[model samples]
Target chain A: MTPFELIVREHGPTVLRVCRAVLTAHDAKDAWSETFLSALQAYPRLGADANIEAWLVTIAKRKAIDVIRTRARTPVPVGDVPDGASELGIPDDERGEVWALIGALPDKQRKCVAYHYLVGLPHSEVAAIVGGTTDAARRAAADGVAALRRAYATIPGGTA
Target chain B: MTNIEAPNTADLDRLHDRLVHAADEAGLLDLAYRTVDTPIGRLLLAATDRGVVRVAFETEGHDRVLGDLAARVSPRILNTPKRLDTLARELDEYFAGQRLGFDVPIDFALSRGFRRDVLGHLAVIPYGTTESYAQVAVATGNPRAVRAVGTACATNPLPIVIPCHRVVRTDGSLGGYLGGLHVKRTLLDLEAAA
Candidate 1:
């Protein structure tokens, strides 16, 4: 088996991107840590032909949900802004603007875009994670991108 | 989106640092490693939470060493260098002729049985001095296990730290070193000069 360190180095950035797409930046860091720690614990048993990136994305999905659930249980103070707003702590750069747009997408569309576009997983794999048909995943991702294009065009000096 | 780039390199590095810290705090990081440039060559140093576990030379193939560690120990390894700072500093001192012995804790989990005993005895051999394999075998309480002693030195997991270079053939020839014979000679010459 290849060393786990190689696994972390090879896939860590992609995994972080996926986490950020699914959750807030603060929560994404936690989910990334939990995903790799859990992956490391089970790495020895992973099959030689396993799709490592997809496997890690699957784990990240579960950890993101865990973080979301934990956040749900906590009481938000009155007048507190919800996540994915202009206060996500992302800098006002082109990349940050793009991430904010992706974050504002509907839940299904956000995950579909993340898994298919960001992580390069197939619609079938995306469906397996999000619990939908392959065609539905494809449509969600396509619709999400089209919506982003329309929204991005209205911003002054925005280049899609 | 087509224009979307992966998170910048600096962001990823910060996230990885946080992940390493969290994994260590949660008792999930079983092995941590880093490479150090030395007078001899770049060396790969690895450790478990117990202590320093493996020290490998570039000639030994760092990738191959990591693979062995994954199979024999745990696969939960990362390239987090903080844990090896003390060991690295001491190595720098040793290579600079300012340190005689290493005081870092060692985990001899890789070697066992008679081999482990022989490695333990290797540390007792004083610097700038050489012990024939027969002498080491006798020191380890088995005079006839000279060949076994040679095997131990050949397979010493933590080579320089354990002082396996101090062992030689009874005829005074350098028998063998896990790091090449040239490296063996270099280390011996360094200590002798100091």
Candidate 2:
């Protein structure tokens, strides 16, 4: 088995991106931590030929859901939640604008887009995580990206 | 879109720090390691929660050592340097000739049986001195196990910290060093100069 450190180094950023795309920044960090912790615990027994990226993405998806479920139980004051950019602590950048756009996408579309586009998993794999047929996953990601394109076109001085 | 870039380097670094903290808190960081540039070479220092466990030279192939650690200790390892901060400082002090001995905690979980016992006796070999394999074997209460003593010193998991470089052949020749004969001579020369 490869050293667990190599696993973290190789896949950490992609997993973080997937987590951030699916959840808030604060919650994304929590999800990322939990995902790797769980992965480390089960890593030794992982087969040599296992798809490490997919395995980590699958774990990250579950951890993201856990964070979402926990957030559902917490009471929030009305109008207290900040927009995606400020909440992610990168308010001034265009990347923040992009994140805000992704965050606004419907849940299934956002997850599909994240799994398929951000990290480059196939729609079939995205479906395995988000639960739908491969065809559905592909459609959701396409629709999500289409919506982003439309929104980006409307931003003043925005380049494609 | 095109702006959906990879997270910035600072962001990834912060996330990694958070992950290391969380892993440490959750007791999942079974082995933490960092490399220290030494007069001899870059040494890979690794620790368990118990204490510093393995100190490897670059010549030993750091990747190979980490693989052995994963197989022998636990695979739940990470490159979290905080755990080895004290040990690294101690190593710096020792190499700079400001310190004679390490006061840091050590986990000898990697060494076993007579090897472990032989390692225990190594610490008392003192600075700026050398002991024959026969002398060490006698000290470990197995005078005839001279070869075993040599083996122990050769396989010393914590080399410089444990002072395995202080051991020599009965003929007053440097028998062998896992770090290489040149490194052995360098260490001996360093201590002798100090």
Whole-model Cα lDDT per candidate? 0.87, 0.87
Candidate with the greatest TM-score versus the true structure: 1
CA deviation > 4 Å runs, candidate 1 = A45-49, A73-89
Question: Per-residue lDDT of B1-194 in model 1, one digit per residue for the tens?
Answer: 68776666777788778778878998888899999999889999999999999999999999999999989998888888999999999999999999999998899999999999999889889989999999999999999998899889988999999999999998999999989999999999999999
DockQ of each: 0.59, 0.61
User: What TM-score would candidate 1 get against the native?
Assistant: 0.90
**Model 2 lDDT per residue over B9-66, tens place:** 7777887788788889988889999999999999999999999999999999999999
Instruction: Indicate which candidate wins on DockQ.
Output: 2
lDDT of 2 at B40: 92
Cα RMSD for predicted model 1: 3.2
- The residue pairs found clashing in candidate 1 are none
Task: Indicate the TM-score of model 2.
Answer: 0.90
In model 1, what is the error at residue B139, expressed in angstroms? 2.7
Write down the TM-score of every candidate.
Answer: 0.90, 0.90
Quality of candidate 2 docking, DockQ: 0.61
